[model samples]
Target chain A: MIELCKVTAAYQEQSILENCSLQVSSGEHIALMGASGVGKTTFLKLIAGILPPISGTVHVSAERISYLFQEPRLLPWLTAAENVNLVLSDSEKTIDEAHHWLEVVGLAGAMGKYPDALSGGMRQRVSLARALAYGGDLFLMDEPMAALDDTLISQLLSLLHQYTQGKTMIFVTHSLEQAKIISDKIYLIKNKTLELL
Target chain B: MNRRWLKQVLAMLFWLGLWWGMAVAVQRPILLPSPAAVFLRLTDFIGQPDFWVIVSSSIWHIMLGILCAVILGSILAVLTAQFPLLDLMLSPLLTTVKSTPVASFILLVLVWIGRDSVPSIISGLMVLPVVWSNISTGIRNVDAQLIEMAALYRLRPYVMLRRLYFPSVMPYFLSALKISIGIGWKAGIAAEVLTVPANTIGKMIYESKLYLETTDLFAWTLVVVCISLFIEKIIIAALGRLDIQHGRKVAASDD
Candidate 1:
């Protein structure tokens, strides 16, 4: 289980989360829904350990945490396969493992292609493959499929559902339908506090 | 490669024809050696044992000096990017170096260093400002969002450099390298000529000029041009290889 106790995080003087508290258990998918710029991404960042709270405690039982950024931050110089390979260990075995993940993400044919040659949906899939291949127990995603078309987004969501069956995911999105599709629990941000529903 | 080769060959032939026409019109070897005369002189120089020594020595010094300058300039750029105070402190000195005439520096270096080392020193000095400015610009222009992404991922320092910084700075760095190498060659040779460094191409050119050996001077000039072009080709090829080895294909996902 992961728990946030009295999490108070702010940017400069602008307080984004104030005394925000939440709990997530293993095998649970939580959707954090809030309007744009209402600190949803900030909350995910804090949970990812990318940002430390001003005064709070976060406890995680997961061995590893992998974050899928809102933007697909693939290195431009690498082919899709090589980009995934970079995050893997240098040995041939680890590389083959990374390539397997690319295939799992439905990027098998596109592995040797550069990101520029891939569609937006394809790029996101590569990013998704990278995060998942890291073998993290907990996945923190900030709008991972926001750029995809409706059909592509649905396909990816279904893939996520199958692949992340036993993993814990704390994903932020403004799409209520997407939250309903993937999340077992929903945390909606209103004003400055999270309202668990 | 074929397209480029054809283009370059055509351009060279056109220029060579122009030079030949000008030489014919002037009809004075002292003023301008004909293309044929220069070719003959080039063959004569090739037969001399000292010719290879002079060319190789100058290449050695210039290459070493430029390499050192590039390394130092890149390190300095990284430091300055991290600390603004260091940049402010060094800006005046770098600007002075950039603004100063190459001739003045050549003369000063001749007095300060031995004649043999002058060309290398001059090459290093000429390359520094060009590299520093370009690298600093590259550092400053790195995508802010990528840095944020690196922060979000908690990327290690070396990982950040490999994934974020190197790809961003590469184009600017390559361009700076191109510009710096050309300038370094000219400045290094000029320094050598003025200093008359023994067993150096610049010294050979100086000797030819002293004896009014216009054909010899032209031959040496052609040798310098060929070497410079060769170096440029090698550097560009290396840069291309780096792009491939480093795997810097631009991602479609960039905002």
Candidate 2:
């Protein structure tokens, strides 16, 4: 579902990922582990088509993609349900779909709350719900549950595992435990390239 | 709230007492009328049917100018933000308008249009640059991450505008509106006074000055201030309601 061939990504003139190559087959779940500022996000952005490689190629077969940014990035003016609904088709059913996804993420009581009124963890959950409600064939998440408690993270991981059954996912995380629970395979960024572990 | 109101009342009374003392010291109503004399003149003017006509006519002209400025300024800001070439082209013209004195514009506009239209044109000119500058900055300052998220979701253009752009720019837009309204009113009244348009508060002020009716001049000036404050209150209240509708907390004083 995703392929990269000698992709070299850089910011300005500094190379973050030099000649990095990776491939994931359909319905594959992969976890990317890396230190801060080590180009894990750079890799995801390349696949999500947000950033272009300075060298080589990247191919993503999925038509629809759902990306959870490192930040919640919720519109301050929109309620939790509305933020989720923002990614969905504008229909009455989508409203219920947004509410349901928020409930699934344990934000049932916060469906009507604005981003300012929400805590950091609550906001991240809303962001997660928005990504889930988008219903994309491929998901690119960058430490989406970093703000949550361990129990909530486990519950959310279980929910995510059930939800993304037939979908391709590449998640970035710093926690080895989370990585082991979430991915079929684990890859770490070592010296500006992916190393399987 | 009541304590605050009482404090404000006391402050106002202090100023009035000082003004009365100064009027007595001057001993010339023509130079500085007492507050009571001005208030009595205002009451007399209010009883006249022409008073409402004059007030309404001035309000209509100034309000028309403000409305036009708001519409055109927003359109120009959006277009210029979208097209850098347009921004480049209009930059000098807006700068010229901003820098030039209001009196110069009033005279220039009077030469081009009728005296009655001069106030509106000058008012619109005074307000346009402020609105354009603030809104364009607002557009530029919208959170990039939010914009990226919107794009990744492939949100429709109108949805992006209505949901993302509108809310982000609203605070800046409201700030511009608040500021420009005061400028528009001041510039419009100054234009009217200079041009002496028919059936306006400016015309009455001018006539009172011509006949040395200082009390009438004070009363007319008071009317202008009152009307300006009233209009500003209405606009702010309306914008506060809009903020509420968008689920934003409305600050008591956005300024």
Candidate 3:
């Protein structure tokens, strides 16, 4: 579903990912982990076709991909329900599905609230709801539940497990338990390249 | 609300009383007519058909000017935001328009385009810069992340503009409209006074000054102020149809 062949990426003149290469087959789920400022983000950006590699190439075969950025990245002007609805293609069914997703993510009461009105954990949950509502063939999540407490994580882990089935997911996360639960393969960004673990 | 109205009434009465006292002190109608005389003149003119004709003509011209300026300003702002070359070339011209006096524009345009086009052209000139600068800033200030999201989602360009750009730019555009309306009125009237259009509020005021009728001059000036306020209210109400009406008073307190 995705391939990066010796892809070197950078911001300005400084190289962040040097000769980084990875491949994920169809229906493959993977977790990418690394130390702070180790270019885990650049790897995702390359796969998602957001950043151009300074050298080599990137290939993504998935036509529909849902990406949950490290930040919630909700349109602050839009209500939580509206933010969820943004990614839904069918306008006629969007409202009901948005409300349903928000409810599933434990944000039923806060659907009308704006991102600024929600707490950090609630905002992340709303973002998760948006990604779920998108219903894409592939998912690229950057620490999808980093803001939630252990209790909330455990509660919502079922929701994640349910929706992520039969699709490729490349999730960047810190928690080993989270990586283990969701990923079929784990890789670490070691010395500017993906290393299988 | 009642207390606020009372405070406003008292403030108005204080000024009106002071004007009456000054009129009495002067005791010369030609030099300084009493407020009563000006009010009488105002009522007399309101009864005349010519007054309405003149007022309506001025209103039509100014409205056309404002409308044209808004359309052209929005187009220019979009182009300038999209192309660096356009921004570089157009910046100095707008700066010159902003800095140049209304009288200068009146004289130059009167000579170039004749008196028929003066009021509308001058008014458009006054409004264009304000609208362009404001909308340009609004376009430039859109959140980069939202734009990226829109791109990734493959949102159509027009849809992206409607959903993201319009809502973001509305407050700035509305504010510019408010300021431009005032400038448009002032410059429109100034242009009319210079060019002496056949039927206009400025023509009536100019004639009053020529005939030494101070009461008529003051009455016409008062009429201009009233009309300016009325049109501003009407235009503001019209903006509500654009789905960005609340943007005028929008101050997001989201924390």
**Top candidate when judged by TM-score against the true structure:** 2
RMSD of 1: 3.5
Q: Model 3: what is its DockQ?
A: 0.35
* TM-score of chain A, model number 2: 0.97
Arranged by DockQ, best first: 2, 3, 1
Query: Which model is ahead, 2 or 3, in terms of TM-score?
Result: 2
lDDT agreement of model 1 with the native: 0.85
lDDT (Cα, tens digit) per residue for candidate 3, span B15-45: 9999999999999999989999999999999
lDDT of 2 by residue, A1-197 (tens): 89899989996677999888889998999999989999888888899898999999999999899898889999887788889998896556689999999999999998877887788999999999988898899999999988999999999999999999999999899999999999999999989989999
lDDT measured at residue A173 in model 2 versus the true structure, 0 to 100: 98
Better of 1 and 3 by TM-score: 3
Show where candidate 1 strays beyond 4 Å.
Answer: A1-19, A52-63, A150-152, B1-4, B139-168, B248-255
TM-score of each: 0.87, 0.95, 0.91
Scored by lDDT, the top model is 2
Q: Candidate 3's residue-wise lDDT over A85-116, tens digit each?
A: 87785255669999999999999888777777
Candidate RMSDs in order: 3.5, 2.5, 2.8
